[model samples]
Target chain A: MLKINSVGLTISAVPLLNNITIDCPRGSVTALMGPNGAGKTSLLKVISGEHKASQGEVEINRQSREDWKPAEIAQFMAVLPQSSTLEFSFTSEEVVALGRTPHATGTVRDAEIITAALAKVDASYLAQRSFVQLSGGEKQRVQLARVLAQIWDHCECEGDASTDGILLLDEPSAAFDLAHQLMLIEIVQQISARGVTVVMVMHDLNLAAKCADQMVFMNCGHCTAVGTVSELLTPELIKKVFSVDAEVITHPVQGTPMVVV
Target chain B: MKVLNTRLITPRLCGLLLLIALPMVSLLGLMTGPVFISLADILSITLSGNGGNSQEKLIIEIIRLPRVILSLLVGSLLATCGALLQGLFRNPLADPALIGVSAGASVGASLVIVFGSMLTANGLLLGLSAISVGAFAGAIITSVIIFRLATSPQGTSVATMLLAGIAISALAGAATNTLSYLADNDMLRRISLWQMGNLQGASWDRVGLCAVTAGFLGLLIPREARALNAILLGESEARHLGVNVEWLKRRLIIYSALGVAISVAVAGVIAFVGLMVPHVIRLLVGPDHRALLPLSALAGAILLVAADALARVVIPPAELPVGVVTALLGAPFFLWLLVVQRRRT
Candidate 1:
C-alpha cells in the first residue's frame, strides 16, 4: 500500500497542494479526478518522489519515501506524465530500454527487457520506429511501457509481500482515442489485479467512473471527496469539484456510475 | 531489429584498448615530427634508455613526447568537457568554451607574451598561469550568472539557458576585442598566436596538472550519466524519476567548467574538438551518456593527436597552429552535417 501523509506543496508562493493525504492499497485502482489547477499532477509528483513537500512524508509499504535510495525508490514507484519531449531519434525500443537503466547490468538483458516491454504495451510495431516521429498517443503508450518496464524490473513481489509496485500517471489518456483510453484503463486494471497499487489523474469522469474502484475529487488544491465511484461521483460533487454542472447516472450494462457532461 | 550487445566486453577491456591505442597514436605523433627518428633509433632508445644518438633521443623524448602527450590530455579534457556541457545544457551545440573560458584564457596568455618582457624572464609560465586562472574564473562567473538569469522562480528552461549563453558569449567577445585594441604591436602578435591556439609549449608538468583535473572530472561526470539520461526527457519528467534537477545542474556546470578551464590553460583554445567528437559519438552510439562520455574522450584524444600530427607535417618545419587544423577539419564536416540535416528535414 502507498500512503501520502500530511503532504503539502508550494510553487512560487502559491500553494498547489496543501496538507493533502491519499492512499492507494494493493489490488485497487484509485482515480484522482479534478478540475484544472487542482493540484492533481502535483500530488502525483509528490507520490513519485519528484517534488519534496514543504512538510509531509510519503510512505510506500510502511517505509518513508526519504529512506529509500533513488534506485530503490524508482524500483517501487513509476510515473508517466502527459507528454514527453524526446529530442533524440532513438528507436522506440531504445527509449524503452532506458526503463531498465537502474536494473540491467548488461546491454543484452536490457534489450530483452525493452523487447518485452514493447510487447506489453502492444507497441511492438513501434520498436524500430524513431520515438521523435511517434504520434502523441503512441508516445504516451511508449512512456507507459517504459515505466511499466521499470516497475517490473525493480519490484520484489516474491514471498508474502502481497504489495508489488506503485504507479502514478497524470492524464495518461488525455490524447488517447476512446479505444486507446479504454485499453489504458484495462491495462491499469490488470496491473491492480496483479496486486500493484495504481493512482491515476484522469479528466474523463465517465472513464474514471468505469475503471476506478475508488475516486478522489480534488478542487482548489484540496481533495473534496474520496469514496467508491457510486457513492462519491454525484452530480453535486461534479458541480463542486469542477465548476461545471453534470448529470450523474448509472451505466445500464455494468451498474456503475456514469457522468453525462 | 537486433540490439548490439556490448556487455561481454568489460569496461576494463575497453580501457585497455584505449590505453594501448592512445600510446600508439602518441608514438606515431612523436615519430612524425620535423626531424623524424627512424624505427631502429626509436627501438634502440626504448631498449637501452639511450639510442647512442643524443639528437634523436632529445627529439623523440624531450620535444616530441611532451607535445604529443599534451595534445592527448588537452583533447581528452576538451572532449570530456564538451560531453558534460552538452548533457548539462541538453544542447548538442553547447561546448566548454561557449561561456568565454577560451577567450579569457587567450587574453591571459596574450598579456603574458606581450607584456612579459617588462615582468620577468619566465613570462610564458606566468602568462599561462594567469590565463588559466582567469579563464577558470571567467567561465565559472559566466555560467553562474547565466544559470541565475535564465532560471525563473519556477524552473530552468533550456531555451532560456541557451539564449543566456549566447548573450554572455557576445559579451566575452566584446571584452576580448577591447583587450586586443588596447594591446601594443608585440602584445597583438602574442594575442594572435594564443588565439590561433598551439601545443608548442607542451611540458610534462602542464600535462600532469591537466591530466589530474580532466581525469577527475571525466570520471566524475559519467557517474551522473544516469541522471543526465533522465534529464534528456525534460526537467519536470526527470524530477518525476526522482532526480534532484537543480543539484544535478549545479554540479555538472562546476565539473564541466573546471575541465574546460584546465584544458584551455594548458593548450591555448583548441576549438571544435569538443563539439565534433561528442556529436560523432552520439551518432555512433545512442545519447546514453554512459557510452557517449567515455567514448568521446577516446575519440577526442585520437582526433586531436591526429590533427596535431597533421599540423606538424602539413607545413613541415613551419608548423601551423593546431586550432587552424581542427577548424579546417571540423568546418567542412559541420557543413556536411547541415546539408544532411536539411535533407532530412
Candidate 2:
C-alpha cells in the first residue's frame, strides 16, 4: 500500500499541488481524474519521487520514501512518462530491455520477459522495428511494455506477501486507438488482479470507471472527491470538477457507471 | 526466439572486422612514410628487435614506429571520449570540444609558447614540455568550472551544462586569440602549428602517456556501458531504471575530461577524429554503448593511423598536419552520410 500524507508541491513560488492525501491499497487500481492542469500528473510525479514535495512526505508499505535506495525502489516501482525523448536508433526490443536494467536476471530470462511484456501490450510485432520510426500509438505501446517488463515478475509472485509492485502511468493511453485502449484497460485489470497497484492519470471518465476500482477527482490542485465509480460518478461531481454538464448511466452489459456529456 | 536481427551488420561482426583491420592499417602506416621502408624490411626489423644500426632499422624503430603508435593511442582516446560525451549529453552532435577541452588546451599551449621563455628560461617542467603541462591544466580547469556552474541542489542539469560549455568555449577562444595577437612572429607560427595538430613531434614519452590514458579509459568506461544505454532513455527514466543518474553523470564528465586533456597535451588538438569517428561507428552498429564504445575506439585508431600515413606521403619530404587530413577526409564523408540519411527517411 502507498500513502500520500498531505503532500504539497510548489515550484518557483507557485503552488502546483496543495496538501493532497490519498491511500492506494495493495492490489487496487486508482484513477486520478481531472480536467487539464488539475495537478494529476504532478501528484503522480510526487509519488514516483521525481519531484520532492514542498510539505509532508510519501510512504510505501510503512517505509519512508527517503529510506529506500534508488535501486531498491526501482525493483518494485515503474513509471511511464507522457512523452519520451529517446531519439536514438534503438530497436523496440532494446528499449523494452532497458526495463530489466535494475534486475540481475540473466540475458536469457530477460529476453523472455521482454517478449512477454511486449505481447501483453499487443506490440510483439514491433519488437524489431526502429523505435524512432514508430507511430505515436505504437510508441506509447512500446513504452507501456517497457514499464510492464520492469515489474513483470513481481506481478506473478502472488504468494510473496512482502513484495508489492506499483505502476504509475501518465496519460498512458492518450495516443492509443479504441482497440488499444480497451486492451490497456484489460491489461490494467489483469495486473491489479495479480496484486500490482496501478495509479494512472486519466481524462476519460468512462474509461477510468471501467478500469479503475477507486477514483480520485482533482480540481485546481485539490482533491475534490475519492470513492468507487458509483459513489462519485454523479452529474453534480462531474460538472463541479470538470466544469461540464454530464449524465451518468450504468453500462448495459458490464453494469459499471458510464459518463455522457 | 528469432535471433534479434535488426542492424545491417551485427555488433559482433563489426567488432571482428575492425579487429582485423587495425593491425593491417597499422602496418600500412609503417610502410607509407617518406623513406618507404619495404614490408619485408619492416617485418624483419620488428621481429628481430635490432638491425645493427642500419638506416632503415633506425627509421622503423625510432621515428615511424613511435609516430604510428602515438596516432593509434590518441585516436582511440579521442574517439572513446567523444562516444562517452555524446552518451552523457544524450545528443548525437555532442563532442569533447563542447566541454571546452580543445579551446582551453589551445589557450594554454598558446600562453606557454608566448611567455614560457620569460618564466622558465627553458620550456621544460617535470620532464614534460611546459606547453603540455599548461594545456592539460587549462583543460581540467575549464571542465571543472563548467561542471560547477551546472551543479546545484537540484542536481547537475544537462541543459545548463550545455549552455555553460558554450560560454566557456567562447571565453577560451577569446583568450587564445588575445595570446596570438600578442605573440611574436616565431611564437605565432608555433601556436598555429600546435592548433593544426601534427604527429611530427611524436616521441616515446608522449606515446607512453597516451597509452596509459587509453588503458585507464578502456578499463573505466566499459563498466558504465549498460548505464549509458539506459541513460539514452531520458534522465528521469534512467533514474527510474535504478541508475544513479548523478553519480553516472559525474563519473562520465571526469573520465572524458581526463581522456581528452591528456590527448590534447600529447597530440595537440586533433579535431575530426573525436567528433566524427564515434558517429560513423554509431551508424554501423546503432547506439548501444556496449558495442558502440569499443568499435568507436577501433575505428578511431584506424582512421587516425591512415590519416597520419597520408599526411606523411601527400607531399614529398614535407608533412601535412594529421588533424588537417582528418578534417579534409571526414567532413565530406559526414555530409554524404547526411544526404544518405535524408534519402532513407
Candidate 3:
C-alpha cells in the first residue's frame, strides 16, 4: 500500500498541496481528478519521489520512502509523465530496453521480459521503428511498454490482499485516440489485478467512470471528495469541481455512473 | 535472437589491441626516417648497449620516434575527449573546442612568444606550457559558465547551450587576435604556425606526458558509457533510471577537459577531429555509447594519421599543417550530411 500522511507541499511560497492524506490501496484503480490549477500532478510526483512533500511522510509497504534507494524504489514503482521529449533517435525496442536498466545484469532473461512488455502493449510491430519518428500516440504506448517492463517480474505481491508495488501515471490517455485509451485502461486494470496499486491523473471523467473503482477530486490543492465513482461523481460535485454542467447518469451498458452534458 | 549481433567486441579488447598496435606503428614510424637504418641496426641499438653507428642511432632513436608517438597519443586523447563531450551534452555537434579551449591556449602561447624571448632565452617552451595551463583553466571556467546558463527547471536547452559556446568562443577569438597583432615578425611567424598546429615539435618528454594522460582518459570514458547512454533520455529521465546525473556530468566534464587540455598543450589547435570523428562514428554505429566511444577513438586515430601523412606529402619539405587537412575533409563531410538529411525529408 502507498500511504500519504498529512502531506503538504509548497512551491515558491504557494501551497500546491496542503495537508493531503490518502492511500492508494493495492489492486485498486484510483482516478485523481482536479481542475487545471489543482495539485494533481504535484501529488503524483510526490508519490513517485520526483518531489518531496514539505511536512509529511510517504510510506510504501510499511517502509518510509526515504529508506529505499532510488533504484530500489524504481523496482517497486513505475511512473509515466504526461509527455516526454526524446533527445536522440532510439528504436521502440531500445526505448523499452532502457526500462530494464535497473534490472539488467547482462542476462538473457531480462531481454525476454522486455520483449514480453512490448508484446503486452501491442508495440512489437514498432520495435524496429525509431521512437523519434513515431506519432505522439504511438510514443505514449512505447512509454507505457517501458513502465510495464519495470513491473513485469515484480513478485512481492499476488493480489489485492498484498501491498507492495504502485504504478503512477499523469494523464496517461490524454492525447490517445479512443482505441489506445481503452487499451491503456485495460492495461491498468490488468496491472491492478496482479496487486499493483494504480493511481493516475485523468481528464476524461467517462474513462475514469469506466475504469476506476475509486475517485479522488481536488480543487485548489484541497481534496473535495473521495469515494466510489457512483457515490462521488454526482452532478453537484461535477459542477463544483470542474465547473461543467453535466448530468450524472448511469451508463446504459455498464451501469456505472457517468457524467454527460 | 540477438538484435545487435555484428560482434560483441568489448571496449577492453579494443583497448588491448590498440596498446599493442600503436607502439608497433610508432616503431615503424621511427625506422622510416630521412636516413635508412637496417632492421638489424635498429634492433641492436634498441636492445644491445652499443650504438654501432652514432649517426644512425641519433636519427632512429631521437628524431622520428617522439614525433610519431606524440601524434598517436594526441590523436587518441583529442578523439576520446570529443566523444565524452558529445555524450555529456547529448548532442553530436559538440566538441572539445566548443568552450574556447583552443583559442585560450593560443592566446597564452602567443603572449609568451611575443614578450618572453626579449626577457629570457628559450622562453618558447615555457610559453607553450603557460598556454596549455591557461587553456585548461579557461576551458573549465567557460564550460562551467555555459553549463549554469543552459541548465534550468525546464532542463538542458541545447540551442541556448550552443549559442553560449559560440559567444564565449568569439570573445576568446577577439583576445587571441589582439595578442596576434602585437607580436613581432619572427614571433608572429612561429606563433601563427603553432596556432595552425604541428607534430614537428614532438619530443620524448612531451610524448611520455601526453601518452600517459591520454591513456588514462581513454580508458576512463568507456567505463561510463552506460551512464552516458542513460543521459541521452534527459537528466531527469536518467535520474529515474538510477543514474546520479549531476555526478556523471561533473565527471565527464573534468575527464574530457583533462584530455583536451593535454592535446592542446602538445599540439596547437587541431580542429574538426573532435567534432567530425564522433559524429561519423555515431552514424555508423548507433548512439549506444558502449560502441561509439572506443570506435570513435580508433576512427580518430586513423583519421589523424591519414591527415598527418597527407600533411607530410602534400607540399613535400615545406609541410602543410595537419589542421588544414582535417578542416578540408570535415567541411565536405558536414555538407554531404546536410544534403543527405534534406533529400530524405
What TM-score does chain A of each model score against the native chain A?
0.93, 0.98, 0.95
State the C-alpha lDDT per candidate: 0.76, 0.89, 0.75
Q: Which one is best on DockQ?
A: 2
Q: Comparing candidate 2 with candidate 3, which one achieves the higher DockQ?
A: 2
lDDT of residue B96 for candidate 2? 94
lDDT of 1 by residue, A6-85 (tens): 88998679898888887777767999988888989889888777678877888888989888777666655778887887
RMSD of 2: 2.0
Task: Decide which is better by lDDT, 2 or 3.
Answer: 2
Ten contiguous residues minimizing lDDT sum, candidate 3 chain B: B1-10
Expressed as tens digits, the lDDT of each residue in B102-180 for candidate 1 is 6556555555554555553434453355555555565566767777877786566657867777787787777677778
The candidates' DockQ values read 0.35, 0.62, 0.36
By TM-score, how accurate is candidate 1? 0.86
TM-score of 2: 0.97
Could you tell me how far off, in angstroms, the CA of residue A165 lies in candidate 2 after the best superposition?
A: 1.0
Superposed on all Cα atoms, model 3 deviates from the true structure by an RMSD in Å of 4.4
Off by over 4 Å in 2: A160-162, B1-6, B119-127, B340-345
Model 1 chain A worst lDDT run, 10 consecutive residues? A153-162
User: Which residue ranges in model 3 land beyond 4 Å of their true spot?
Assistant: A155-163, B1-60, B118-128, B144-167, B334-345
Model 2: per-residue Cα lDDT over B134-165, one tens digit each? 88998999999999999999999988999999
Q: Rank the candidate models, highest DockQ first.
A: 2, 3, 1
